[model samples]
Target: MMTDALTLLRTRKSPKVFDLAAPGPSPTELDQILAIASRVPDHGKLAPWRFIVFEGDGRARAGEIIAGVFVNDNPEADADRVAIERNRLMHAPLVVAVVSRADAHAKVPEWEQTLSGGAAATLVVLAAHALGYAATWLTQWYSYDPRVRAGLGLGEGERIIGFVHVGTLARPQEDRPRPPLADIVTRF
Candidate 1:
């Protein structure tokens, strides 16, 4: 069972786009997934990650806000691009924004806490896969934009680690080429 689980982890890939037909997980299921995602390594019990759920009309609201930010940031941006960006939020039935909160008081370094947040995000993807859902972790330009951060109500010390879009796979993905382990791995 452990080997099978490991194999699943190895095979998991982020889906680029999801089906609109994909159903959102129930509140109980979401809570369970969040619980699993929260178990990532934390050196000082300073849980450094937070989640914001965007569903229903909230998704539309997010899209509008993001589009508005884009227009403000790039006056030359075309309406089509803004529309496309606005439509991105409608791709999935549910989206979860993962934020990393840097800890200032812990003996564990801030970098470690940030790493914990990253681990938590990966755990969220894995948990979604285990629950038979397709997910993608994305961080586009808006992720780093101060306006976007303010729209999300994030604090000064918080950063958008990732935005996880979860839903059903629209179709089976063809196998893509992967770099050989030898190319990237170095055994000291």
Candidate 2:
């Protein structure tokens, strides 16, 4: 079991979000994934993050907001571009927006708080993979757009760290090349 867990971590890879299909995690499975995702190293116990789940009709609503913002910002955008934005979240059975709410705290720096949020997002992907699902963590153009941000209900100092798209992998993916350990590692 220990070796299996290690192997899973070692070989984990995210498929393209577009390649993801339906039959996502059930409500209970999602609850478990979220619970596992929340267990991250948080200094001062400042859980400076929250999750916004987009599933079923919720995905369509979120996509519409994104598409609207894209068109508003880029009036010359073609129909294809607009449609892509509109269906961005539709490909995945579930998309969880990890919002970082790091703020000024005397006990914890804002950077550390933000890192904790990133850890949570990473865990979301890992947990989903462990449960036999494909997951991709992404932050597209909409994640930075002011109008889209406001439309998604983000408050001051809140940022979208990632949108974890989860579903079944439509096809197998080849392993990409990894950087040499000697080039990246050094013992100080």
TM-scores of all models? 0.93, 0.98
In model 1, the clashing pairs are none
lDDT digits (tens) for residues 7-47 of candidate 1: 77987887776443368677887887789989999998999
Best by TM-score: 2
Scored by lDDT, model 2 comes in at 0.93
Clash pairs, candidate 2, are none
What are the lDDT scores of the predictions, listed in order? Answer: 0.84, 0.93
Q: Number of backbone collisions per candidate, in order?
A: 0, 0
Model 2, runs deviating above 4 Å? none
Candidate 1 wrongly placed segments (more than 4 Å): 18-21
Identify the candidate with maximal lDDT. Answer: 2
Error of 2 at 179 (Å): 0.8
List per-candidate RMSD values in Å: 1.6, 0.8
- For model 2, what is the alpha-carbon lDDT of residue 123? 95
